[model samples]
Target: MFKVKVYVTLRESVLDPQGNAVKGSLNSLSYTEVQDVRIGKYMELILEKSDREVEETVKEMCEKLLVNTVIEDYRYEIEEVVAQ
Candidate 1:
């Protein structure tokens, strides 16, 4: 079995209003040293053993649905699961 982890984040050039809001709230709570905050997403997918290449399949999934390539960037890692 294989497990895939996906991370999606806004592109550096894009503004992240949600992150800004959280940062503002943190500062109001006395976290004044917080310089900046960037929010992103994390996802886990479990894949059954197959002849297909994991890298290619994950790439297709990310580009087609999991990420907005125009305004966001994504990266992933795959790990083998040992069944008991």
Candidate 2:
């Protein structure tokens, strides 16, 4: 078995209103050290296969269908799960 962790975030060039809102709240709370706070999505997937080719294919699927390259950036890591 394999476990995958996916992270999707907006590109740096794009403005994130949600993130800005969080930053504003933080600042209002006297958290002045917080700057450029950005929010992203996290996903976990489990696959039955543990092959290098399959991992690459899943990554490509994320880039092509799961993520919008123009505005969002995505990265995924796959790890083999050992049974006890």
Candidate 3:
């Protein structure tokens, strides 16, 4: 078995309104030390062993559905699971 962890975030050139809102709220709460805030998405998926390469499958999934390539960037980690 394999476990995949995917992280998606706004592209560096993209404006993150949600993150900015959070930062504003934090500052209003007197958390002035925060210089910026960037919001992101994390997901986990499990798959049985397959003939396909895990990384390639994950990349295709991300590019096709999980991420908006024009505005977002993504990365993934794969871990092998040993069934007990």
Best lDDT among the predictions, by candidate number: 1
Clashing pairs in 3: none
Alpha carbon lDDT of each predicted model = 0.92, 0.86, 0.92
Q: Which one wins by lDDT: 1 or 3? A: 1
Candidate 3 segments whose C-alpha is farther than 4 A from its true place: none
lDDT of 3: 0.92
Over all chains combined, what TM-score does candidate 3 have?
Answer: 0.93
lDDT of 1 by residue, 1-84 (tens): 889999999999999999999999999999999989999999999877563788888999999999999999999999998766
Question: How well does candidate 1 score on lDDT at residue 73?
Answer: 97
On lDDT, who's better, 2 or 3?
3
Query: Tens digits of per-residue lDDT for model 2 on 1-84?
Result: 788888999999999999999999999999999987999999888777658576787777787888888999988888888755
Per-candidate TM-scores read 0.92, 0.87, 0.93
Clashing pairs in 2: none
For every model shown, the clashing-pair count is: 0, 0, 0
Give candidate 1's TM-score: 0.92
**Model 3 Cα shift for residue 26 (angstroms):** 0.5
Model 3: lowest-lDDT 10 consecutive positions: 47-56
Mind giving the per-residue lDDT tens digits that candidate 3 earns over 1-84? 889999999999999999999999999999999999999999999978673688888898999999999999999889998766
Residue 58, model 3: Cα distance from true site in angstroms: 0.5
Of 2 and 3, the candidate ranking higher by TM-score: 3
